[model samples]
Target: MNGNRSVPSRAERLRASATLHVFYGGIDLMVGSRFVPHLRSLERSQWYSREALLDLQNRKLRALIRHAVDRVPYYERAFHGIGLSAEDIHSVPDLANVPILTRESVQNHFHDLTSDDWRRRHPVVNATSGSTGVPLKYLFDRDCVAMGWACLFRSWEWDGYRMGDRRALIRGTDFASKGTPLHERIRRHVERNLVLSSHAMGPTQALQYARAISEFRPTYVRGHPSALAAVGKAMLSNALALGGVRAVYTTGEQLTARQRMLIEQAFRCPVRDQYGLNDGGALILQCPASDAGLYHIIPERAIVEILRPDGTPASPGEAGEIVSTDLHNYAMPFIRYRTGDLAVMEDQQCSCGREFPTIRRIEGRIISAVKRRDGTRVTGLVLSDAFEQLVLTRQDCVHQYCIVQNADLSIRVLVVAGRGYDDTVTNDIKQTIWSHVGKGIDVGVERVPEIPASRNGKRRYVVSHAA
Candidate 1:
């Protein structure tokens, strides 16, 4: 007999594959079964080539349009009014034939926008409480919810997170209630995630949150950029170091370069920014292979288009309004929805093998400027930069702050005071604002319990009423 080892038989290989399926199946059961199909689909879709992905997109687009026209009254009317039919929109470019759906349209025809049959599938209805304007209510079916979570978790996996890996979230949710709710405890157990309340955060609270997160030994930390930066600043000031943190994820607010630097330096991890809307559409996430600020659009979730003021497609690196269409969510079809946000679309492919396209940067939503006494208009980002710079320099004095412009051209600065906060700090902030916005504008600083987030879980740095 030859002294050689024999290769494993087909039976043995089949047994090994069976064991893996069982192992992952058990984990899926623990995490909840709805995500199983969606997660697997996303895993497979990422490997698709550009042409294959677009082909898949076209198929989904056709199905979505057919469903919209057949079931949703609003789309039925929109298509008929434009002398277009579901058969006419066979590709992404054909989508332009259907006019853009504005927020006002959604508000005016809320019922018609939703499919009556989808309610049986457990559709959740909610409203977006944006910082600037009226809230817009929308519907997301059960499958849509699962798909969205799957895409979100896929992004988390880019930073080395697994199904049961521990993570911490600092969002607008009120987690500081007297006691945790039963459902919340169960949710945390199932998801293996913790929530730190952003609404109750201050200097003292930030220290507590930092300590709590340190104890949890979370694999990832996620929250609004400002809130996360504040906690990171607190950690740095107190010489606190959290171990085993794989990455920090920021969303729901515009993340500045300074915020990324602070968060990364304090946490000893990279910061990944995610952009999307609450209407169950437009999910763009930063992939592991992307540069510092680049994000990849989840092709399965939505089709994102950047259009110029002339209603034409913007060139690569040209800033334009972001118009997106949800490829899923047939319950409430949002075709050609105007997101009101601005971004630059990258024409180049990423080093990552994934075919998902990249967004160069997300400049915040379009809003009128705060008119000054000299007929000058100052945008929110410009004035907000003054405080952002302060946080960069004196990390201990200011944690989270906001600037609000009144109708009389007076400005009010709301400060969630941190360590070293005092009259001198207030005066410095006033002087900082005066320097940029010009004098004769009444500027006042007010310390508060917290700078509450808008209803949709966003902490806007500036709210202007003058414009």
Candidate 2:
């Protein structure tokens, strides 16, 4: 151990543990939730046999279906119109009989989707980031929120994280911003969470965040991959590193290969990618037991189905849309809801011995693709790979970028210049993009101070306005 390094005293550690217990205990008591119990159940449930997991899903599904049909007006009417009932959906496969719930449908039937017994569930209203131009408001029960935290904590355990472990959060939610309530500030301090805003991740902000995180010495760092990658780049540029970070957890955005590499190099820790949707009720975490980028689906949290366009289940290795049923959300059930995200189905069991189903890859949102003039389409993953490679090879040339496709199929590359940015770097970016998307399209590279984030403070790498 370095003599200069500061270690927490025994009394400080005991105080931190007691504070965490009181904080979580107060929350559980206020909401009538059993968070710690739920977390413990999940820890054991993750190792259940495949048949046991499926049986658990079936039981949860039956109960949820009965509740939705009896209490939710939207599901009740839809089931009646389709000549179906809760009895028709006894198993996961029987869910095919239910209509696919779309975002537009939810918006139209907002009030109808709420369960009649929602008042008893301690409901909380929430909204999506409206990244698609229209935000959708929804309801979440207190128990459902508690289950979400339990599922997340269980996933974090794959990286050796414990409940009271010190961690840093670098995402859109700015807990340190002005006007934050005193209680919220105290809660953050008691929880030992270092929250850094990702809204404006310029070089200066990135440097500051890097310095703060390094000094904080968190066991793990969690944030959007883009934001973390920016801080990682800053740390590398200034030769700074967070000495004791065991892992980096990335969510909210796709974690590209180059981004993962940069983060791992800067933090000297492995990067774990997590896929989740608060509105959609899907939580997929990277399989720590495998290096193949496979994600394990939490069976107790949501029942995920990878279905083809025809509404049939996709075969293993086939790419399909993700439809999820959040089992714990009774305030407003999302049964067979279309999440609009794509993923590849995997049929193999993980070496970790967890019976939870797996996904080979998360292909991102369905609408995040670029169309070419010749009717060809390039997915966001491909474009991100191209841009990431360009940045990796020409290090310090580009801090951030957004590839926007105009209605006319013209491509505009908006770049936040880095220290080593030059004309050659711009040409390299253009060439990289042209390689993936044919040169027949008009491509322009523009240097900017920063790329704008969405309403939720997520910086999208690809935005297509072409219809």
Say which candidate scores most in lDDT. 2
lDDT of each: 0.78, 0.84
Q: Which digits, one per residue and each the tens of the lDDT, describe model 1 over residues 172-222?
A: 776555568886686676556888778755668888888788778887889
TM-score of each: 0.83, 0.91
lDDT of 2 by residue, 322-434 (tens): 99999999999998889878788899888787888999988777666788777767778779888888787765687678888888988999998878889988788889888
Question: Candidate 2 versus the native: TM-score?
Answer: 0.91
Candidate 2, pairs of clashing residues: none
